[model samples]
Target: MSTSSPEHAIDRMEDRLARLPLRERKKLRTRRAIQDHALRLFAAQGYDETTVEQIAAAAEISPSTFFRYFPTKEDVVITDEYDPIMAEAIREQPAELPPIDALRAMLREILPQLFETDLDALKTRLRITAEVPALRGRTFEGMRATFTVLSEAFAERTGRAPDDPDVEAFSWAVLGVLQAALYRLLDGKTTYEDLPAQIDHNLRFLAQGCPL
Candidate 1:
């Protein structure tokens, strides 16, 4: 339901870029260029078959430069700018709303805009991540990182310690439902356009005590 187009997303990205110091803006641009070239290479070739050297060549950077941007080939597939954005969005949700409701609201607001920004790259990343064992293993690390982000944001909003047992449980529960929905998308059971609805449904299930 957001009429936000890719152009709108690009304009927003440009605005954000303009606010960064020149050096930081250059670094961010380089990082994005590397990721774009890497994803294209991954899509053209297979994930495993696409060498780091090849991606560097495509991006017109050295392999060492590629490593400076992404530590590993798998990192190119897994790393993204979305986590901090999501964390901020989580914190900005209506204070009166419960944590799960806030998260649901944030996803509803952000995901469509995000999808519009780079749906093709996201689809390629998800497909490659699903089909590759190394990427799958790497994602557990990413999941843990995401859990920390969610927990910290929830803690800030709710005035709880980030490490509090209740906060930890709630964050992991949200991660679980999100992971399940991602699996559905990777399995072709859901389209990108429908993914937010699927995530909303899953979160609603969790909010209802997760009855069997």
Candidate 2:
């Protein structure tokens, strides 16, 4: 019953979007539509087999419009919008809370957004990442990009240098848990709704120093 769960974060995002100018909102919708259709097409056909023109056609946008939103086809799967949001959430967590507790809260804040996401699309994306070596490399690069933001926030809270070993270790451990949870979910070991509980249990284990 955390107050700052995914639904709450979504509510905040909705409010912010509500205040955006009409043009900006329309742009956001168009970007989303393009991404949604791109994923659908990518899932139906293999990534290498799917062309940008096909994706654009499915989304009812021209190829030029697709490029305006995403620089390349790989960018659609590589770039993640949640990284900054979660990083900011982690930074905004109460200073009085313990490190793990703060991280848990941050995860909760984002999980609701994940819940609303298209699980089929996510599974397809993960599957593609697993199957494509180039995409896999890009995915790791994308993860490193987010890790920099998260590690800095962790360092600030711990009063350590951003590159301090302790900060890096803790950040990697957290990311590892999340990655494992995601893989398990994609592998059909867990359902979409079970993600929160699985993440909660893993975080609790880490909070307890990873007991056997």
Candidate 3:
């Protein structure tokens, strides 16, 4: 059984914040507060019915402050803190490891911490993203941004340009596997406890040249 808990996640986040400068830590705290309140409002009132003003009020911030952190309601739903963390973790992997192997290792280390952070909020975010038309349309934009982060990390490790065809292909392929896993979870075909393993399996398949 999973040993993850919300309290542990909060502790982990606090530990991370303890390392940052005061201003940056405050900014991150506010950002997390806004997102947390937004997700709660979205889940309770429905995404279309939950106004930015309401979310801002719930978060104890002004609507302008909301815009400062998230440009739009859609951004509030789709954006996350994971991409930068993933980029850094990928870069920190052993230089001798291949891109796919490095990704697998990074994900193995990161996914459990992520799942522990706030699985319920994560599920609500994914559900809203899947159900809302505006958010669904914006999913590709999010995917593009993630792809760029992944491609740049891979390029830096391999000494190639971010836009190189091989880098782009490998990055997009990883995204595809991740998207498939998310869809399965959203469809109730798999539990969150199994998601990391599923992702790892697909990455292994990709590493094996996707044999039939």
Highest lDDT scorer: 3
Give all TM-scores, in the order shown. Answer: 0.88, 0.74, 0.88
Ordering by TM-score: 1, 3, 2
- Model 2 lDDT tens row, 102-164: 988887866766555444556677778878888877766677867888788888888999899
Reference-based TM-score, model 2:
0.74
lDDT by candidate, in order shown? 0.85, 0.77, 0.86
Candidate 1, position 84, lDDT:
62
Off by over 4 Å in 3: 1-27
lDDT per residue, candidate 3, 174-206, as tens digits? 999888888898789998899999999989999
RMSD of each: 2.3, 4.2, 2.4
List the candidate 2 regions with Cα displacement exceeding 4 Å: 1-10, 16-34, 44-46, 56-72, 117-124, 130-138
Please, what's the RMSD in Å of model 2?
A: 4.2
Residues forming the 10-long window of minimal summed lDDT in candidate 3: 12-21
lDDT order of candidates, top first: 3, 1, 2
Across 109-152, the per-residue lDDT of candidate 1 in tens digits comes to 77877787878889888988988988989997878878888999
Clashes of each: 0, 0, 0
